[model samples]
Target: MKLGILGGTFNPVHTAHLRIAEEVRERCGLDRILFVPAATPPHKELAGAIPFADRYAMVAAAIADNPDFVATDLENRRAGKSYSVHTLELLHEEYPQDTFYFIIGMDSYRSLGIWKDFPRLFELANLVVAARPGIPCKDPLALLPVVIRDQFCYHESAHMLRHRSGNIVVFFEETYLDISSTQIRRLVSEGRSIRYLLPTAVEHYIYRHGLYHNDERF
Candidate 1:
């Protein structure tokens, strides 16, 4: 089985999120894409994120229509700061026979070395990075220590992750929706419309819960 792991805060699920999942599923021949919401990211702290339950609910609702896309609270359910390596380890254990491909943004991929047990993460599963339009592999190998640089290759697309080992695969897709949870909160706080920024259900949930009204950090 081939599983695609899309992990993020998902303070509010958006259409672009779904689009990326669909693209990966079809292009990468993935059997399933699990959307795992982060509990507390190691690099940054969430400021105005809606309650974890609410974020999880919105994610579930947004991906409910797609059988291939499912939401998992593995990171949120676990204690302490959420680390990719730990999550990958747990996922590997749960789906022993499945090939796990981690789907993430190119920005995250560039910072892989900064992550905890970065090399172990690659050993556990392939890393699939979704690069924004026109963004080159932002992280240069020259910046990394010699040993870690040797572990990765400047390759594009999920196919590289599937076919190659010891490297991160990047998939550059066109996504015009440059929206973020922080931006969404700002728009909502200013009484602006967020019709296309997120799913209708998620918008409704945010407004109904009065989230991000006073804070727009997350």
Candidate 2:
């Protein structure tokens, strides 16, 4: 089975998160998507993030009705900063039979070299990068390390790179909402309406718990 993994600091899971997962699942024929909420993401500062429990609950509530969506606590249960390489390694170990595809935005893919175990991550799971229309990534292939670059060959017919080991890099064009967690946090702090910006349950959960009412540096 092809499993899609989307990891992030879902301070409060929103509609956009669900949409992206659904889009990728349908576009790539994925069996299901597991939302892994980062307990402590190494790349982002966690100064203003809500409690891990709260974040986890919100993700669960947001995806409650979607049979294809699953909320996982893999990173949350682990100790220390949540690194993608470590997460992928553990996932590969536990689900040896499943083909893993990690969904990431183009912005994060640009900094792949900085990730833990950098190039080796390419071997653990296929990467599916979400790209907005009208803007192509600036020489993404050239940006990859020489060794990793050699692992894949672009197949013009599929518009994707087929890796030697069957781990591919699929460049998927998707319609992503402009909404962001950062923006949502800011809006809540300023008493602005977040209606339609997030799942109704998540929006209510944020307000009920005063998740980002004060909005300290996210």
Candidate 2: TM-score? 0.94
Give lDDT tens digits, candidate 2, residues 40-131.
Answer: 88987865757889999999999998899998889977898899989998898878999999999988888788888887777889999998
Worst 10 residues of 2 by lDDT: 136-145
Q: Every model's Cα RMSD, please?
A: 2.9, 1.5
Give each model's whole-structure lDDT. 0.76, 0.86
Clash count for candidate 1 is 1
Q: Which stretches of candidate 2 lie over 4 Å from their true place?
A: none
What is candidate 1's lDDT per residue for 1-218, written digit by digit as tens? 99999988886778788888888788778999999988887888677746778888989988777788888888877898889899999988888999888887766766777899877776787666677777665444554445665666654332343223643554556464677777787788788898988888788888888877787464
Clashing pairs in 2: none
The residue pairs that clash in candidate 1, if any, are 157-170
* Residue 147's lDDT in candidate 1: 62
